[model samples]
Target: MKTCILTTDTYLNHDTGQGHPERANRVTVIIDHLKKLKSKDLIWKKPTKFDLEYLAFAHDKNYLDNVKDSFPKQGLNFLDGDTIVSPGSKEATRDAVGSILTAIDGVMKKDFNNAFCAVRPPGHHAEKQKAMGFCVYNNIAVGAYYLLEKYNLKKVAIIDFDVHHGNGTQDIFYDNEKVLYISTHQYPYYPGTGKNSEKGKYNNVLNIPLPAGTTSEEYLDAYEYVLKKLKEFKPEFILFSAGFDAHEDDPLAQLKLKSEDFYNLTKRTIRAAQLSSKGKVVSILEGGYDLNALKESAEMHVNALLEF
Candidate 1:
């Protein structure tokens, strides 16, 4: 089966102010690069609208109402110091969450082996009640919730490889034994939440914190913990909060992972899926600012998905 690509043009309209790092060009560059591949295996699809209940599975209803009411008709509004919203951000953010739902549906229906969501307002940091770190909704968390609620999956694994820790994802799923949240991120970094000792209520959350200036080899070595735990859990579905910001060229964090390292990481993760989930994997874009680094790393990530 082909690898599905879920995105929409509305992402370009969800503008953060000028000179901001998470600009529209990040998705633009990634889509452009993927188009150049000319692979017949590519299945591009628009995001479908999902019911609010899907989002409510992971977020509080009041928080959803606040995000809906926070949209300004003319100027930009701030959800936090970093997360900004414009008039168009409502649809863009909903689409970001919706795209993952659609991708999961496609995978579960056997429409595709796996899928990649190239939506914006990158989501890994948004908690149940607050939006932060340039994220409006916790996309992968919502998707994992959907899988549990809709498909009746017993265990789902969420793997985040962003340079910064996925504090919000951890917050949402920390006590939920049905979801295993694993993250490998730079220590003592932004939002500062992914400590090794913060294991979840059910010990379902595994955090492998790496130091600054960590090289590719060291990063991969730390990833072994993720693979080992995933094998033990044997999740019914696998979801990747794919973030390319750990690339050496990224200005956000200090990790030195190259573009090819993403391919290796993804390749290994897919193999884990083979043993655990029958190749059921869904990847959602989270963070990556440097245009070239984002583009190359995204391409490498999708390439590995397709190769699998």
Candidate 2:
């Protein structure tokens, strides 16, 4: 299998100051561990510069201009209470969006079978007009639009396994019939949006809200519902909002998933979507705080991607 890892060092400069869970070290640790693998099967690539018009596809024009003006020279600027940006964040945020777009191009051109983007300043929480939950431009959302507009793909499915609900991704595609957004996240949690009833306008959104202490068995059981939904949609392309914070070791969430569970989750998803998608899938980093668990869980997810 041709598997690529898309990333860049600009993430290291996206400083969030001291003690922030979404710090630069998060991606650093995962990249470091991945380097230890040193497998010839893995191709490392950097995010390519993309047209800013793609940003307008996922975010409001005014909001895009505001984000452009929000980057501070010396200090950090906060888009929301938690979403912080510094001088280097300008490039970091763009790269975050670029990472997914680049990976999509590589997959579409058959340069790689699939890819995992390990970029930072994680997106999935940024709505069309606002940033929240440490997310800026909703990178995956733009990638979905890229598939829709560039490849003219009619059906695109975004499966979010992040610990927190992808409130922004749902917000962006709630009314679009071409895309299906399904997420299994901890509910009654921060941002507090993912109710089982918040289906999209086209019924394209499926939010499976788990309790605070959901176990692996329970979570996987719920994931079966996600698989069922994917089977029905028969998407031509799939994007994973891959977050590892659901692990028991993560400090941010209460879910009790082990590292190996990610492998099972990813494998199940791939098998379910392969026939319709022709094995075209791209995954990007979202939320995973605990360094050790994040590293292990990411590797497991990639392992499945490779084997499948």
In model 2, the Cα lDDT at residue 18 comes to 81
The candidate that wins on lDDT is 2
TM-score of 1: 0.99
Global Cα RMSD, each model = 0.8, 0.6
- Candidate 2 — which pairs collide? none
Each model's TM-score, in the order given?
0.99, 0.99
Q: Write the per-residue lDDT of candidate 1 for residues 130-234, one digit (tens) a residue.
A: 899999889999999999989999999999998889999999999999999999999988988999999999999999999899999999988988988988899
Per-residue C-alpha lDDT of model 2 across residues 76-115, encoded as one tens digit per residue: 8989889999999999999999999999999999999999
Task: Give the per-residue Cα lDDT of candidate 1 at 229.
Answer: 91
lDDT of each model, Cα atoms only?
Answer: 0.92, 0.95
Give the C-alpha lDDT of model 2.
0.95
RMSD of 2: 0.6
